[model samples]
Target: MTPDLADGGAASAAPSPAAAERAARAPLMSVRNVTKVFGRDVVALRGMSLDVRQGDFISLLGPSGCGKSTALRLIAGLSNPTSGRIEWAGGGRTDADLGVVFQEPTLMPWATVAKNVWLPMRLRGKSFASCRADIEDALETVGLKGFEGAYPRELSGGMKMRVSIARAMVTRPKMILMDEPFAALDEITRFKLNNDLLAMRAKLNCTVIFVTHSVFESVFLSDRIVVMAARPGRVIHELNVDEPYPRAEIFRTSAEYAAQCRAASEALNEAMGGAGAGHE
Candidate 1:
């Protein structure tokens, strides 16, 4: 059972450095010294490295143009790195093993929520009759059980986003990569989605790499935040959020949360300030 976050303790408790060392034991994917360049110049990323452990939620946090999305794209194998490597543990994992959620819902205007969610399964040659239960389960997981017949235009912004998420989850991928999926929503909706996201992640036990510019969101969601810098993007700091799962409102308002947010904010500021550059 998932631990109750409402009965909070030190949700942002500081773990020993060795804690990460322990988590690193079952590394799922590693992005090592990867770089990406466009045209003659336009370096999007440089020497970027990150380790994704199984069942961990990691956030790539940074300012705009910091290559957060670029990193996600590289991990999704949508693009090639200019240098370095991306390694997946126990190898031979294909695109079928991944779920991707972009900033926009990107739903089909002509399709129902169920159809949109069914797209992934259908692409894998799964007929509606074959995976109908899985699509419904994914929708229910995202709190949209009764809205399967609804069109994207008929749903609220938050609901549309939920459909997008439902689509991603339908495939039951080993890992999910999200690029600010909730950035477009209002605070209340975003908060609700954040909680639901934790619950879903707990239930799915899938590893996640989320990219966002919101420090608070990153602190609340991530086991570790990979803070990055721009102008040839690279990781500058890594801050661990030792908080427990099912993070509740009490945890959010707690002093521990504030402290973690401050630490992340400071790290982000320093990253934006260019603590170390001169690469690429």
Candidate 2:
């Protein structure tokens, strides 16, 4: 089972035993000295590397054009690194093992929420009749239990994004990649979804790699935060959130959360200021 949330505020300020244990286990995937270059001019990522362990909630935290999304795309096999390799723990695998959610909902406008959630399974050759239960379950998990029949146009912005997340979860993927999915939502909606996402993740026990520019969001949601530099993006710092699962509003308001966010902010600022030097 995933570890429970820390009882004391300070307990979350540093890496916990549970986080260390998880990190020591075999990684689900590793990006080793990866580089993504466009033509001969644009270099998106430079020698970027990270290990995503099972059940980890990792946030690729950085400013715009910091290669956060590029790294995520590489992990999803949506794009290949111009140099270096992305390796799976089990040696080799197919893209089917991943569920990717872009910044936009990108739902089918004409389809019901249920059908939208069912698309992944449907593409995998499962009929709607067969995956009906899974479709409902994914929707319900994202707090859209009674909105299965609602059309995308009928739902609010947050609700539509929830549908997108539900669709990603419908496949029971081993890992999920989210590229700033909540960045466009209002604060209230974002907070609600942040809490909801933790619950959903606990149920699935899947690794999550999220890209974001928000320090608070990254601190609240990630077990590990990898801060990146721009202009040939690379990791400049890595901080362990160490916070427990099922994080509630209280955790968000706690001093521990603030401290972590401050630390993350400082690291990000340092990354932003430094020149894109060689990655050690």
Which residues of candidate 1, in runs, are more than 4 Å off? 1-25, 274-280
Give the TM-score comparing model 1 with the true structure, all chains together. Answer: 0.90
> What is candidate 1's lDDT per residue for 1-280, written digit by digit as tens?
1132211223334455635553665778989999999887999999988888888788998888889999999999999999999999998578578999999999999999999999988887889989889998999999999998899999999999999988888888999999999999999999999999998998898999999999999988987788888887888777777766768877889887997887777677766773434323
Highest-TM-score candidate: 2
User: Cα RMSDs of all predictions?
Assistant: 6.2, 5.6
Q: Once superposed on the true structure, which residue ranges of model 2 sit more than 4 Å away at CA?
A: 1-15, 274-280
**Which 10-residue window in model 2 sums to the lowest lDDT?**
1-10
- The global Cα lDDT (0 to 1) of model 2 is 0.85
Backbone steric clashes in candidate 2, count: 0
Superposed Cα RMSD, model 2: 5.6
Task: Assess candidate 1 and give its lDDT.
Answer: 0.84
